[model samples]
Target: MSPEFATRYNRWRYNLYAPVYDRVVAAFFAPRRRRAIELLAPAPDERLLLLGAGTGLDLDYLSGCRQLTAIDVSDGMLARLRRRADRLGLAVDVRVMDGQRLDFPDACFDAVILHLILAVIPDPVACLREVERVLKPGGRAVVFDKFLPDGGHAGWARVAANWLTRLIATDINRQLGVIVGHTTLHIEHEESAGMGGFFRIALLRK
Candidate 1:
């Protein structure tokens, strides 16, 4: 599918799922989300960006951050995220923006939190490249998502299943190595986050 088509389709899908997104995803991924941000270790005065920030699930753990900005394509999701941030008394700059096309200036962020977006975004490489561009030298980005292990191959069945998964939710067969290989960011640390090793939390340095 064309990147434009995939991006629009996923945005519509997530907007439709926004109302119940927390119910279905929040509880299950809460621990992992917190863990990913913990690895990010945002300082009190740090400028942090939450790319693909869905329903503001990461806001609670990021209250200490002074400059917090979040961007997502789904306005429905961002609306909920704004509400969550308000309730938590955290100041957040929430905008409806595409992950693949960040509007921010280069090398502006101290850290970036990418939770559960790599596999879901239409162009993971473009998104990662943007992440790398916007990060300050020595800036950190913490990622939490399910990625096919390095050098791992997806069986025919899994590849077939990926078609439907990509259409509706995420691309399960995407590899972190393949995506990150296109950018200058280096993987600093990686460890199992959940789903019995299916999901991983990784720290990348730019």
Candidate 2:
């Protein structure tokens, strides 16, 4: 499929998945999400962007933040996120925007959070380039997602599994290093998050 078609399909898929998303994903990803935010270590007043923010699962962890903006292509997901922020009594600037093409000014944010986005977003290279463009010099971004191990080849079995994975939710064969390499972002730290290192959390600097 074309990138545009893939993006549209993702938007539709996530919107359809929005209602039960929290119940299905919240518990399993909570710890990794928390760890990713902790790695970011944002200041209270810093401007932070949560790219591909879905259902605001990360809002609870960011209650102390003053300037928080979240963008997602799925309005259904952002609607739930807004409600979540309201319950947390935090003011968040939430917009329905594409991750590959962020509608933000250059060097405007102190930190960017990419939780489970790389594997799901179409054209991960474009998404990372946008992240690099929006980050200030020396700014950091924390990425938490499933990636094929660095330097490990994706065998036929893994490649075949990715076909189904991509159709329903996310692509399992995406490589973090290869994606980040498309931009100037540098990986500062990386650690295994879960599923025998299938999921990873990494800190990237721009």
Per-residue lDDT of 36 in model 2: 89
Model 2 / residue 104 / CA error / Å: 0.9
Output the TM-score of candidate 2.
0.99
Tens digits of per-residue lDDT for model 1, 98-177: 99999999999999998989999989999999999999999999989998888999999999998888787888988898
Off by over 4 Å in 1: none
Cα-based lDDT for every prediction? 0.91, 0.94
lDDT of 1 at 89: 90
Q: Quote the lDDT for 180 in model 2.
A: 90
Q: Over the stretch 3-71, how does candidate 2's per-residue lDDT look in tens digits? A: 999989989999999999999999999999899899999999999999999999999899889999999
Q: After superposition, how far is residue 32 of candidate 1 from its true place, in Å?
A: 0.6
* lDDT accuracy of residue 37 in candidate 2: 92
